[model samples]
Target: MLTHTPEMPHALQQLLDREAAITTLALPRRSFLKLAGATAGTGLVLGAFPPPAGAQAAAAGLKPTQQPSAFVQIATNGDVTVTINRLEFGQGVQTGLPMILAEELDADWSLVRSRNGSSDPAYLDPLFGLHMTGGSNSIKNSYTQYRELGARARAMLLSAAAQRWNVDVATLRTRAGEVIAADGRKLGYGALAEAAMALPVPEQVRLKDPKDFRLIGRPTTRLDARAKSSGRQDFGIDTRLPGQLTAVVAHPPVFGARLRSLDDSAARAIKGVKAVLRIPGDLGGEGVAVVADGYWPARQGREALKLDWDASSVEKVDSEKLLTQYRELANQPGARAFDADMAPLATAPRQIEAEFIFPYLAHAPMEPLNCTVRLGKDRAELWVGTQCPGLDAAAAAGVLGLKPEQVTMQVQMAGGGFGRRFVGSSDYVVEACHIAKAARAAGLDAPIRTLWSREDDIKGGYYRPMHLHRARIGFDERGNVLAWDHVLVGQSITTGTVFGQFMVKNGIDGTATEGLRDPYPVPMRLTVHHPKVNVPVLWWRSVGSTHTAYVMETLLDEIARATKQDPVAYRLRLIGDKHPRHRAALQLAVDKSGYGKKQLTAGRAWGVAVHESFSTVVAYVVEASVKDGQPVLNRVTAGVHCNLAINPRSIEAQVQGAALMGLSMCLPGAAITLKDGVVEQSNFGDFAVPRITDMPQIAVHIVPSAEPPTGMGEPGLPPLAPAFANAIARLTGKPLRELPFKLA
Candidate 1:
């Protein structure tokens, strides 16, 4: 229970002073120039007029939004509670964050509990400059903050015990909720709780030396494992409230098509149908809501409702037509996303060319789209599972014509968001607000839960835009790459939408052009972004990397085959020094799996792909074969570097799950097909997902690093598709240049 202050031990101070002196005179002459430009710009000047002594910029993170609280609160009864801001959403962040806090707090592990925090500014992300949980930032971003919180709390408790015992704080030590003095006298944390609160907050704290860390780097069971297994926990689908009525909407079969008219006479006659409202401009399109005493009655009433749709314009739009148009647009000039002026070397003696097409994909979350809104004249409250609650609140208020504060958003456990939850325009939550406000204008209780049928959720707007890619690589007679050219044509994810404006300021959606900038540093490289401008699109799981990684990694694999070099060895030479973690993972995966040594059955082969996303580096090797003339993945091995490695088990779970999700998206996951602008796949029967029998044996190896934890949820997704696609090419002796690989 030693309450060490900011003052360092004299021995440590002397050691640091000697090290600083040694570093100052050992640099090269030009080092000072670089330091002046970079280090001096950090607000310190050596020879110039120094600012007054006390003018040091108030310790970097002193913003009004930053909070000093981030650890466990031990109640008098020994119940340890924690307030976490990161959304759980089945990512296990709720469990991972608390593990860090508990280890530093020195709490009784068995008595600890965790919960989500209220929407407060104290939870802002230091990186996003705002409060957000997406981009795989939950654990990577909060680990240190949460740990510091515990360390600060531990210091406070030690100070309190020192005051009560009247003993020198250094003679006291803490372990598992008790403060013990050298004389063997002990005091529980609960006994000193009040005194601890009165102590001044420390300006600095030291973390536990890694060798002494007990819980971290160790496999601890998930905090919510019991509740989920026993079916006691409530997900969004199981939510309920008093006096709540069920409602359902039978929206149009296509986007931009309005409801010209509808007949609800049969629906109104249903047994439990309370009201059938033909609302105008609901969700800025055709809207019809059937309200009933229960969900079953509303569902039954929806089946009887008939409507005349204004699908004239959309009637001409189709998936096949869009695909053809995208290919045509790829040849024409659009916005240039990244350019390297490779036109001088365009006429090389030897060149390789290929085209890759990606189809439209859906974010069919398990819970579908649902929201419960209770609206009054100037006040509203919405209960839903959204990734961005602050943004959701603003959108809710705008739709209801109320001030932002008038709307209260309760973030529930999302079944899944991916990138689907951040959507602003044409959002389901916006539609729910419209429905609730409309119901109130009709003078009812004004509280209704809008439930989107599985079909509506699938056929609705905002899909992963279909993309077409054309690439040409110029090589010398020595087989060295001389130039690289890539042309991409696809619907800009941010065009003509609220988010599109911010993302396309320079007429380029950085997301759409990522992974194309060519960090490979070839002699000449050019990437052109041609905006297709078709249907409304949104970000899916890995955003642009989902498609871009496939193109880049698969093309590199082709080059490896052309050079007759090992794929791993070839990528190792091309990686340069951009990402050391990626290199480490590549080497580890290649070594552990014996990647190029063994062969599976004839006509079966393996492929390797590596990528860095959300701060984490991941590499995947897949073993697959053509089954019945279709690519079938039989096994997968992955190496991940989520630095600092919080809960190795949880990281493994995320990597395994993300790999499976990626596999399903590549092989059998659902896609949106349009015929005359009408989506054909309405539900799971048509939009297939991976079943248990479809999963391969996935093995995960975690490479530990001290680089601070990065994102683990999504980095594993980008490489799976390319790995599987490359494996298919090896097995069939032909590169499958499109998604949903079709073997011949």
Candidate 2:
């Protein structure tokens, strides 16, 4: 293993390490390259992470990753292990990406395995140039990258076998884990891996034509499926290290509220309680972390603490008052996202004015937030299922007063994280580091595991920003949109983060207005209002589209209703030929659902909605009914146009899960309410999610396309709620405005 010296600059050290990695990949075979406290074992290891398209021109000296050896490693037993760059939090990238590579490498599917990557620069996203995962772009961005990696590795293996057999490299072909000579001699990959690694990595290689792909489009089961199904899969929350101590923090009642006084007499008296120390929390808030041998005692200690909070510095956000303020702001123009004439709205033959309220939502991954930090004299190590390890490491360095390179953020498999783990502030990671630092200062020198209970995870801040969208639309009898005026009011999720500069412009956040009046080509003038609030807000699952799509789709359906037009036909007419993907998806959903053909149950009505987000289009044709004083989604038929399907099963899984999450929004108690500056919902009892009894039967259909795949993680969610609401409206003859279907 190669290591960096103290006097060397990190960049220069990386350069030297890069050279060594090249040597290790091409000639020395068994050598490993170490960086940022990450250690590699004997096998082929990759160099830098994949770069974005034209990223080389974006920055000087940046190039696409050239070392194919870095990603694929063939063990002696013929098992292939692929290193995945992004976090594997239930999105099948761990399987899909490897499938892309292994498809080109022609490896046996059963022997393929996957491992996680850390904050090492080699793990940065190929497109975004960051160590992060969100936007549902993981497969879309990395498709070509992994394909190329596998192709190059295959070339190297062929060359190695050719040399061994004394023949031309062009005469060799690769099959499942073996290279075949023209004379029918076969050499296993494990036998040739060392020699293959010794060969110089080819700068370029030809990718396989889609027609020849064995794994790329196949519906393969995830490599982690069985372990996950049997509950044997390990998550970061299950991490255990010797001498590890658990901590439970008592947060202030309000956002940014500081602890005025703390009495830890009873807490410290607990048997396993090691110490109780004050620590900083999200939004400049202060809290007490109770350290104990395990979670139970730490939680008990936290419950025993007598505390008083000072909330004078923070705004006391009340949901009722805030909604009123948002409604008032909706009438006033704050910033222009789209400006078009709205004079025709008043004189149009039909008109509709709608206001939609989307409550703050929690990500609520199965595993609550957890981070384990072990501090050394000059360095720190962390184990967590973080979305962006590099950002988390930097934040940890600041909290530990160590150099960024001194901190190693080891990535782990997460249970789930729609968008919660990818925080701009690295809130949970920083909080864990702060607890570690304070414990060290208090002379409790042990590895600290900070755990958030289900209650803590739900009440903890960084929720989806509550949004109110008001739209006034006018259309003719033919369903041609004459004029539309729209306003969106919400807190900006990126206003104060590193992304603010890129995502916010001229006082308007791009995220807030993303899903408004697009693909429909309506002459819509959109105004956005970003009110400052003390409550913390972050992206949750589908981000702005969560509310924006609901508003846009439902309103369009209403216009279709008023104009006596079929919903699917109207949406297709608006989309036209320009947006083939949208039209195709909507048409597919309609065709597959047997809309205007298939008969439904006596009370069930057809609901239709289509939306495009993250460069992918999803259309939902749902059969729904109002049962037991609630809107019941009986079945969902989804038409997904993601261009190319990497793993159709994964796409189906994502759609099913995301659609259910969308359905959760329409159920009672789905909203996360704020009352007098405190979160009203603490657990699943008050903060509702979908139960097994509530799950609707769903069938996902992919539009056949040879184009590159788009995002699949988020697009399926946006259309579900609106489609359900549209059906509920048909049943009651009154359009539903708010979520959770407040039936009278």
Candidate 3:
């Protein structure tokens, strides 16, 4: 705002490799130009616009998904390359989605390859109609769409084969990229692909039954494994162009601080320095961009510049003071989210009052945020790793004084986003476009690469909102909740953005209250407070689940402990039959972890936590011990129920990665604090993340089902910290409330 810097363990690294390193193709900026109905610079834009020409064709009856030319490319040698719609940023969708398509296409696994898609109309999410890759919706939302794409392509191939053989289409069958006639004659898909494109796309094509699937649910190795592991993978930061100049922005230390004065005399004297530009910053403030022949000189030039900032216009957000303010706000009435009877809270057999404090968190992806923009007379092209490609393109066009149709956003495989690259503001992209425009005006007229160093990424404003949760609960001795009143105070992540209309309702942001209640059928009255703060905030990985899941799971575990009932039994009884996915996941984790049947090592204790986020449910059973006064996680067993498994290995790897990310929240030095409106932490040394040495032995077990797939990218994270904390609480005999656990 955006790898152990959101870097990863070995298993997690595999998922990341598969996500970013698409096999066998060094796709060019216009590699997707041949995509059916996918003309460069012509896709959906931010607000309202006339249907793009490509979209108009779809409206005229050629559904883009049904067009084989858009998704499938059968090379003359029987190799099939599939274009993935979503940005592959370590969720493994770059491979997992292709497995779904290739399964139906009957393509030979060894010859299958993948590449990233453009911000084309056909590449939009089939359900949401947006160029987005968040919410773990890559597989969940596009499963059927991609399947139908493969089915249509296969059908077309069969038709072409049948026409050539002078036989009925039904008389031919497909097997391993070949069409087989009833008489045993075989024609490879590559042989018939050109003719297949001439045939009309079928309006309806049948998908394969789950029982007949070959590629899915199998622990197959990723096709791009070799490329990424060999350090040959190229992220957006690696973009290089002829006569390209690198730019570094000298930002204000305070959020939204305007540039008061600048002295660039020494900066201009640097050998490689070309021009210095004053441009709009991430916020509405001003920042200076130093342009040079390369990154080293750009960085040096920026370091040499003398600048003064005016921060009086923006509020100085002090974390400690904000905490006090939030506590006071929590004491007052707020906009209602859940309105339940709280009469019983006044008098009950047992009562528990708790206040949880969570500080701002950074999405510090290993590869820092960067964007490269090349501008011509009337058009602009961008190379970036972004979650909102279309929006970014539209924003770029706006900044470049061109129409949306004149800008091309060449989507690149990101190193890791974790919501850092999906900013509603298009902050970094906008900065790059402005830099490009300013450079061209200064007679540079060359592509400009705007790079954010680790320090810039760390101190950048957009962060997971600091939240304060106050809960007063009154329950009977049986641990049955009678009345619970809860209040949450945090900045709204989608307040003024395009997503605010839906994400924010009445006056409360739904993100802050997403996982709070209803899962347990608890009688809870919830109130939310969205305070105006100078610190910019955005979604971080699991978003609100970062804190909500912790509160719910830990409180539930405390209730179970207070009632002297088994935690699992209590949760099961509370969950009941209404939520089978949660029950299945929890039971699987309990069974696989040997929770009750096997005794743990002498100092180790067990912790169990289950939560549902992004429609997928994950349960974690963990073993932990206090070593030298620090809580050390020993082992973890997870049971995930995300419906059907696309790739078991990918799911396992994703869970392992997400579990580590979740564990990071509990590690000391994980929080991002502010003193007088400036971020205090800058790098991994100060802002800690989990490395392999800190990771626990994790085993991910997926619950078998064929109810289609749900999100896997984020569900694994919510349950982790809670489970670990529950184990620590058992050993300490006190419930833990805050993150980055303080034993004192």
Total clashes, candidate 1? 4
lDDT of 2 by residue, 651-734 (tens): 999999999999988889998888889999999999999999989988899988778888898999999999999999989989
Q: Candidate 3: where are CA atoms >4 Å away?
A: 1-62
Among the numbered candidates, top lDDT falls to 3
Residues 557-634 of candidate 1 have per-residue lDDT tens digits of 888887777888888878868867778888777766668777577877888998877777788888888777677888
Cα lDDT for residue 337, model 1?
Answer: 57
* Worst lDDT 10-window in candidate 3: 1-10
Candidate number that wins on lDDT, 1 or 2: 2
Following a full C-alpha superposition, what root-mean-square deviation does model 3 have from the true structure? 7.3
Q: Point out the worst 10-residue segment of candidate 2 by lDDT.
A: 1-10
Model 2: lDDT of residue 700: 90
- Across 568-674, the per-residue lDDT of candidate 3 in tens digits comes to 99999999999998999999999888999998899999999999999899999999999888889999999989899889888888899999999999999999999
Model 2 bad stretches (over 4 Å): 1-64
